[model samples]
Target chain A: QQQVKQSPQSLIVQKGGISIINCAYENTAFDYFPWYQQFPGKGPALLIAIRPDVSEKKEGRFTISFNKSAKQFSLHIMDSQPGDSATYFCAATVWGNTGKLIFGQGTTLQVKP
Target chain B: GAGVSQTPSNKVTEKGKYVELRCDPISGHTALYWYRQSLGQGPEFLIYFQGTGAADDSGLPNDRFFAVRPEGSVSTLKIQRTERGDSAVYLCASSLNGRSSYEQYFGPGTRLTVT
Candidate 1:
């Protein structure tokens, strides 16, 4: 069973436009939600993360909006650039589960300049 | 500081062959995790080690797959009598502890291809 589900397997946006990706989870036990960006041939890097206590978090141009009641979270990238083109994965984990993450299917994002 | 490192970035083996993948986590990190990712799919949890002991290994596909972190720093994922379906990129991650707030640092991953 896929505990975390992500929509839009792929996305395309013009340069300087806003890019959004969404993810949903069914496990209420999840407390930490994080987003990872992965380039080809490299490891996934931490993009942004949010705890259930916060409704939203913003860092630079990346923002994570979390809805605790809906069990959903979304990532928004303002001024999306071509360099931002990569695969994005959303993950969820509980507090004491050895930090093992349950990841979404992933979304391939492309920003055209 | 160096991030997580994985050896043998790529490996190709014939079916029924045995193989091992290695991962060296960050210094001083006591929590380590292993995951497998297939083509066009997200990473799947395989096993987790907290200090020399496996804290969670329920994600392992079967008995043929096993992992060990003897010293709590380096981990080895072993596959016996490998099948073609075992082909995928094996990823290793580590954090300061198994706490929820700590973010995991992932390695480049080892791509295993079984013919």
Candidate 2:
């Protein structure tokens, strides 16, 4: 069973538009929700994260909106740019999880000018 | 500060050959993790190290796979007998703590191919 699930296997957005990627998880014990961005031939990099206590978190142009009751979270990119094109993965982990993380399949995001 | 670094960015070996992948975590990061990613798929957890010990290796597939972190800084993932099924990009990540809230920094990854 997939503990965490990500949707929109692929997405295409116009530059300067809002790009959104969504994820849902089955484990309620998961307290940490994080999103990672990965470029071709490069390792995954932390983009933004949120805890169940907070409904939203924003850093620069990246934002993570979380809904605990719904068991869902989404990543919003304001003013999406071409450079933002890459693979985005959402992950969840329960506290005291022994450093184990459950990751979603992934979504390939593309921004066109 | 330098991020995590991995050696042998790409490795191609024959079936039944032995291969070793190396990982150098960020300085002062005590927790290390290894994951495998196949084409068009999400990364799968493999093993984790807390300090010099393998705190959690439940993700390891079988006896053919082994990893060691003797100094709590560098880790080596060894496969005694390589199989085509082992072909995937091996990723290394490190975190400041083994706790769940910490974010992990990943290396470029070592692409392994067995034929």
Candidate 3:
């Protein structure tokens, strides 16, 4: 079963516009939610993460809004740019799963200039 | 400092052949993980190593898959009698420790094709 589910398999946004990707999970044991950005021929890089205790967390232009009760989390990119075009994956990890991550299917975002 | 590194970025082999993929983790990192990713899909966990021991290996698909981390540094994933269904990009990741919250740095991945 897919523990984590992501929406909008693909996305497109203009420069300076906001881009969003959403993910939902069914496992309540998940405590850590993270987002990863991957470009072609490269490994996924950590973008932003949030714990269940926090409602939201932001760094630079990347933000993660988490809702524990709803078992959902979303990533928001402010002022999306062409360079932001890549694949984004949302992941969830249980505290004692030895850092094993359950990843979403992935979202390919395109930022048009 | 160098990040995680995998050997033979691409490997093509015939079905029923044996193959070994290597991963060199960052210096002093005690946690290592192996994952397999298919085209257009996210990576799936295969195994995890804490130092020289495998703390979790439940994700391994079958007995044909095995991994080892000797000397608490580099690791090798061995597949016996590989099949076409085994074709995928194998990714290796490492962190400072095997903690649940530590960020895992990933390698470029080794693409294995079983024909």
* Lowest summed lDDT window (length 10), candidate 1 chain A: A92-101
Q: Clashes in model 1: which pairs? A: none
In candidate 3, stretches whose alpha carbon ends up further than 4 angstroms from where it belongs are none
The lDDT leader among the candidates is 1
lDDT of 2: 0.92
Model 2 lDDT tens row, A1-113 = 43798998999999999999999998888888889999999999999888899999999999999998899999999999999999999998876767677889999999999
Q: What is the TM-score of chain B alone in each candidate?
A: 0.97, 0.97, 0.98
Interface RMSD of 3: 1.2
Candidate 3 pairs with clashing backbones: none
Residues A56-75, candidate 1: write the lDDT tens digits: 99999999999999999999
Q: Write the per-residue lDDT of candidate 3 for residues A1-113, one digit (tens) a residue.
A: 43899988999999999999999999888888989999998888889989999999999999999998989999999999999999999998876669988899999999999
User: Over the stretch B7-110, how does candidate 1's per-residue lDDT look in tens digits?
Assistant: 99999999999999999999999999999999998899999999999999999999999999998899999999999999999999999898743689999999
Q: Is the docking of candidate 1 incorrect, acceptable, medium or high quality?
A: medium
Q: Which parts of model 1 are misplaced by more than 4 Å?
A: none
C-alpha displacement of A89 in model 2, angstroms?
A: 0.4
Candidate 3 chain A, poorest ten consecutive residues by summed lDDT: A93-102
